[model samples]
Target: IVSDSSVLLCVCISLCLAWLHGDPRKVLHPTDSYGRFCGQKGTPNAKKPILFYFNILKCANPAVLINLQCPTTQMCVLKCPDRFATYTDMQLQHKLSKSYWEYYRQFCKPGFNDPNKGDFHIFRPNLLMCVCVCVCVCVCVCVCVCVCVCVSYRGLLISLVVSLVFILLLRFTARLLLWFTIIAVIFLLAYGMWYCSMELSQLRETPGSDVAIVDVGLHTDLQVYLQLRQTWIIFLVSLGLTEVSILVMLIFLRRRVQVAIALLREASRAMSYIMSTLFYPVVTFFLLAVCISYWAVTAVFLASSNEAVYKHTFLVNTFFSLCQTFNRTNISKTASCLGSQCTFAFYGGETPYHRYLFILQLFNLLVFLWLVNFSLALEQCTLAGAFASYYWAKRKPQDIPPCPLFSSFSRAIRYHTGSLAFGALILSVVQLVRIILEYLDQKLRGSNNMVSRFILCCLKCCFWCLERFIRYMNRNAYIMVAIYGKNFCTSAQEAFFLLMRNVVRVAVLDRVTDFLLFLGKVLIAGGVGIVAFFFFTRKIPVIQEEVPTLNNYWVPLLTVVAGSYLIAHGFFSVYAMCVDTLFLCFCDDLERNDGGSEKPFLMSPELHRILGKSSHSRISPLQILLVWDKCLPSSNSKMLQVRIKEPKTTEEMCHPSNMSVKILSHSGHSISRGNKSNTTTPQVYLLTSHPGSVLRFSKKDLQSTAHLIFQTHVHTKTA
Candidate 1:
């Protein structure tokens, strides 16, 4: 039951302590044998950055592994030796000229100028070969990352086009396209199972291909396992099971899927009005990126704050003294021997702050989760407010306010920050508990007790479900906060009961919509992945010249595939939020407004048609046809009936500014007449408040009022 303010205070304190005690330089720079940071400003070894090892071959000694430190001297040097020169050769050349000694002395210990003590030392190439190998590997990886990042933009662009097209198709042909997507996925899985079966059959005919996967164990090369028949059999079984499950679900839930598709189409229509909502995910992404960057830096600095531990001269003397006192025979011959020492072994300290550093790291993770969830909550509330405006509007776009997205964003930031933060804090606590449980599970992975493992597994599953339930509840609570401007607890209670009231719809239609959206994302990612695979593998002759060559083509191919999925997910998240918001609004509309004349449903005509709820329930068919009885000339004398409740007063009828109407033709085409000069068909004059009072407008006046309702000839009915 941690409050938002308490969470904020804890985060501030953790960040403050981390910054005050942590030294990022300790993580960045290597340390010398003396434990001083290399290249640190104003330090003794400020000019020398790279750590050099003396007799680097001795690092292979078994004692190095036991002690977790190299068993040789290490020095901070400005640069590696440019050429190979053994100490013996340097010593031989030192008698003739001091130049070789001058150049080679940089690699030796600080005041050890006597060359004869460096007996049997070869100074094997300054250890640059090993350093170069590591540097080359790092450079290659960085280059690959850069190339992948640059190439990923193409996938992102394609995903943008594909997602936009998908949304548009959903708006126009939701049922058809959704059914197509589902069937395509099922067929694709079936094809995969068939392919795996074929591969398994072929492998059965080959010699030595029947080896069990267990016999090969775990090999670094995956091709070894792929060559075995067991791998194909596993793939075949997995695909077969998946295809069967999907087919069964589709068969049983076909009706519910139609309802979900209707909801998706409505969401798409809402998005069509507020296209700006599609780009709001970019703002969420930027905020999340900032939170992630800050958390990563704080974690790194806090982890590097421990004091550097090294093997010092005092420790070496203490060890020798202990040995002399206990062993009692090593002092006489070993008195004049120069004992070896190690450089930095590890990072740790006996200080109380260092001892409690793990607690600080945990605090950091909690704050990160809180901030990330808060960002997500803000996005949800803002989008909910925007779509709620769309749903509640009496008329479609004309009654809808201008810049609804911006207005909703402003409202969310101005008033609901605390509510969002509170919701985020609740979710963050559950997520933190789940993370801790996962960590414990990983730590106890090797334990032999079946009871402990089972208990841990059950705890993990319970917490995982709890986390998911909290997330779902928090999402709906944010929507309620957007609509009602209530506190987190009240909104959450109301949202929970509202959902419980319609649990069947929530379980069936809502989940079906989610599954469809997930399928769309997978299709987009897989389609783009297939295209990228062909291009990268040079399977496409046209793009072979454009593709960049790499040692492993799959690296960039996988990067493109993953990036496309994320981009598609970002786009699809907006649609998901819209659907959820509209569903909640629909439920609220049904519960509160019963489509009576006084409490008409605010949902659109299509929703009413799909859900079979008419807003003109209280006002029966004849009551809506209130007609004026005056007859006009022979050329145009059409009786006009306005589908509105009978007015009690004359002013209410004459000046009906609050009335909303849809004008339509006999053929069901919406019409708004503009000019009298182009009156080839027919025209209806404006009626005054009195039953027989008529007011005729000039052609110019009709043209001016034409912009108000820009359709063709039609009857009038209040929507």
Candidate 2:
């Protein structure tokens, strides 16, 4: 088709050129392969078919050889090879003749003269929008954080409100109720005096008499009794009653003072064991959290039956809610996380079985979060580990040495015991106030009828509290020695001795503070007793008698209460002194047993109290490792919402709601790499000594509910 058109164009051009004298050039049609103007007699109308044949031939398969002849009016065109014949590899066999595939190769090259190798950039608006989006998210996060911080810092109201909310949510609280009591007492006293004055004025004047008349009497016993009016007798009786009341108050105050002294004296002893208690208000909240946790845990362990489980759980929760606020004080999760701890971070002991405890711990945390969403939490993540990590990260290797924490049990005992004492002192004050309030309310309402019942109740309460303290102390003592050592450590004993010596040196306050406290007691006692006497004389005309009644029951009863108070006060003071002496004796005796160098004492009231009681070393906080175990005790039917180490494998459609557990072998042993006893060590070398194994393993935290726990394994020899 191209040849025919070219022949026609050539003939026309030749004839026209002969007519017009023109020149011809084939260079302009370099892209065209068809023979240019070969036949001079070509018609212009036949050019279309020649061009179409040239296009078809250009795309023809190279594998086939085509032989063709064309007329004088036709044009010959060579075919271009198929585009699929491009060279993937430079190997010679697969290569095609370069010329035959030129059009195809050129077409595949993308553009006729693209200098940019596929790296060519078509127009793109720069994605500043993406950067803008990233910037916006960052800005949003930062703004939210800033707002939170600003609100937290700016609002004292927030602090106050949160504190109040937390305090109210607590199950046990020590509230300051003195302001209300003092106000009530002041108003009552004012009202009583005003009423008394009115009554007395009316009594003095005869009801129908125009003027007040004085009854004339000669200087007889009658005149003496009426005007001076056995009132001197009333005065003497009141004084006696006042003395008795002072004595009783002195006793109560004395005990409180003694407990406070004991706590101050033993400050070095009880740091670790105290169950940091919330005030009464939020005790319920804490309890609620525990109950919720337990309920969820129980549901998982006992999967199937809903009736028995829900019924029992409800009853338990109700009982827990109704329980006295004080009962919620001592529960702690610190012991459980490290229970059955392995020898090293990545190692287990005895059995070939491998347990990735840390992962298991994650499960525990999951359960905890699921069960108890909100509570006063001490997360293990926040404790010593984070600070240690941070400090180490910042610190130089040369600067590092030992980070000594709590090293022994004797020391722990002393520190924790002191803490307990301090806590007890505060608790005692709370108890005293509570009793006083209860007493006042009861007497005013006449609920118990007996006026003396208030004192009896107070005494009973005191006894119960003391007993509880002793029991707790004893339990901790046994546990400490078993877990760590006989004492927190040996230096602990020396510290106690030093503490005692200082206490003795500062004996100056032995009588001073006591005297002041005694004064407060005396004032309260005397005021109450005299006021009562006045009440009986002026107001209660029920037991009226012509002569001074020999049978004034109020006098004898008041006397008994007062006398008991005084005697009890004095004797208890002596008993307190004796207890202090006992503590001092123990310290002295222990010192002699140790044969350690003694230091001279520095006098201070704190030192004196400490000396009087006993001296013990302080516990290094490091020794007291706090672990997070968010699991319910097995004694409870409900489990805490924590992942169990043992996953339930079988479908427990049959597992009853109340999980029945049986005890299996629960045994433990301690393995120390070094010498077992470092007992007779001196102070300087003491820190270097290889103290044998101190293992605290427990089966309580294991997946098996039936296994026994080894709380006593390291501490004692079983019978």
Candidate 3:
């Protein structure tokens, strides 16, 4: 037996070696009994068939390999059968087009050409049957276990159902409240417009003769009064049309609006989740501080270098002007004056100060652009990292630290600085182009020529589209960099590809999320406006006395609205980013995990539960794996030893060290050596080491082993 085993091992080794070093031609084209190649018929004074030669030899003699006809040399000779008149030189030329070494290097190795010789390839068609079997078994087991668990926990199930019902009720109530608010706002605005029109008409109808004469004397133009009345009428008509349009939109696009609202809620929830972390606010403030400092320094540098004359000569005035530009305020009057002075200073003064100022301004602009891009990139990176960390913790079911924001932020600055800078540079260039185009468009609007205006309009539209595309790409790239630690270009390319691959899903998600955010902004701004209006009107007694003096209530209301919008945008932007980061992470998780026991999903349990419910019929493999994992003994238990027993029938074959003995009772089949006991020894199996072998133990067997171990320990203690 030993000799036979040795012979078998030797044969296996020999076969492996032969496969690794064997010639392809010898294996593919064997010689027949007549000592001729299988495909060849006769031998003649011609060249040997090129197909029969090895790759190495064929590469050395390229000319011979290229020519199909037999050579004049005695060693290179061949002849074909009479029926093989369909031979063509084109076949040989095609085969020898590339050197044999190159072809062999690509399609074949030195050894046997067996594609399945490497690691287990899940994509192989042959594995489909096995995968199907495993899937079906897993599904069956999961269903049975789930049913049993549900039956055992009837009270919990009831509570879950009640909670779901309550949630649905709340959602419906919220939607109704939103609709009511919209209607109320519309009606109030309409009433205010009607009142304004009535007052304007009354004023216009009152003649100058009927007016009360003042001590200083007063003059009135009837034409101006009439124009004012006309304006009121037009405003009333526009307001009415707007109300009608809004009503039509509410009726026609109710479903879309609801979806947008739902998406916004989800985005808000995602944002809140991140903000709940302790360090998020700290990180946000740190970034803000950096931006503020950078902005101040940049402004100072530009202001100090200005040699142009200003109405106010102090450098502080120039600094304030720069600040105004940074805030996106319309400082066209101040800017125009500065531009004219600068040109005059450049040509008339022509001093070193003027030249230095020009250089400084250019340098400041570039630095400002860079800093803006960097700040945006930094925020995105930090937020993305925080979201990714949260996702990782949830997916792995691990206890994360109270605040990992600093760690993530530091990593982003250290590892992703280059990527961030690149992204920022691209974004800055796009923004600069957009600004230039907008300026040109504004200038063209003043021109009388229609063609120039039309051209500028087209350019503006194209640039707007381009700017949006670049921004989307840059945002996604930053997220990718945060998650994967890739370079800017690679991350951007990958992000583009990922979006392209899932374009429809991305489009739907983006539209839904954007609408939801837009609605939130409107709600915030409008709510502030309404509150301010009521306070100004003395409807709120608590704050009526504290109201500031304003020329009109509308002025204060509009200011509050704008302020509220800006605040809302700042707060909600973080949430919107969180939503985007989580979404990309989710997409990556779907692609990487196959729902196998070995490859667990990296997503939250809540997300998994939601997915399971939605895809119950076509349950993901990961879900099935999760179910199986739950059924298994907890990996956290260190007291239990897991063993895979080998197949064996003889009791002696099992090692003594590997087995434990225990006493048993005959009547109850319990372990007790002292009284009413009978020895009922359980059979044991040996263990083997084989890659392809799987050892499965019955639940009954495992239970018996546990019982035996317990009894043995007890018997020893008593003795």
As for candidate 3, its clashing pairs are 46-76, 46-77, 47-70, 47-71, 47-76, 47-77, 595-621, 595-622, 646-686
List residue ranges in candidate 3 displaced over 4 A: 1-273, 276-363, 394-398, 440-454, 548-555, 605-719
For residue 625, model 3's alpha carbon misses the true position, in angstroms, by: 12
**Weakest 10 consecutive residues of candidate 3 by summed lDDT:** 339-348
Estimated TM-score per prediction? Answer: 0.71, 0.19, 0.48
| Model 1 residue 531 lDDT score | 86
Provide the global lDDT of candidate 2 against the true structure: 0.31
- Tens digit of per-residue lDDT, candidate 2, span 564-606: 3443343223222322333333344434432111321212222
| Best by the TM-score measure | 1
lDDT of 1 by residue, 396-501 (tens): 8788999999999999888888898888887898888888888787777899988999998998899889889999999999999999998889999999999998
Error of 3 at 91 (Å): 99
Angstrom error of the Cα, residue 252, model 3: value is: 6.7
Model 3 Cα lDDT, one tens digit per residue, 1-719: 01223323433443343334323333244322112344444543123442222122223332322111122211111322111111132234335664422322222212223333334311122211222234357797676545533332332333333323322332345455445546665776677588767866686765552333332243333333334455466668887887787677678767656654544343344444445432343455566576566544443433333232223222223453443231111223554333212111111124564445434434444445655667777788888887777666632324444555667688886788777776766666677767667767666667899988888788778878887888888899999988888888888898888888667557766765665555555655655566656766778888766655433344345455665665556555666787688677766776676333344455653343322222212222112100011233444532223343432221212223322333333233554322222344332221222212112223344456533222222122233
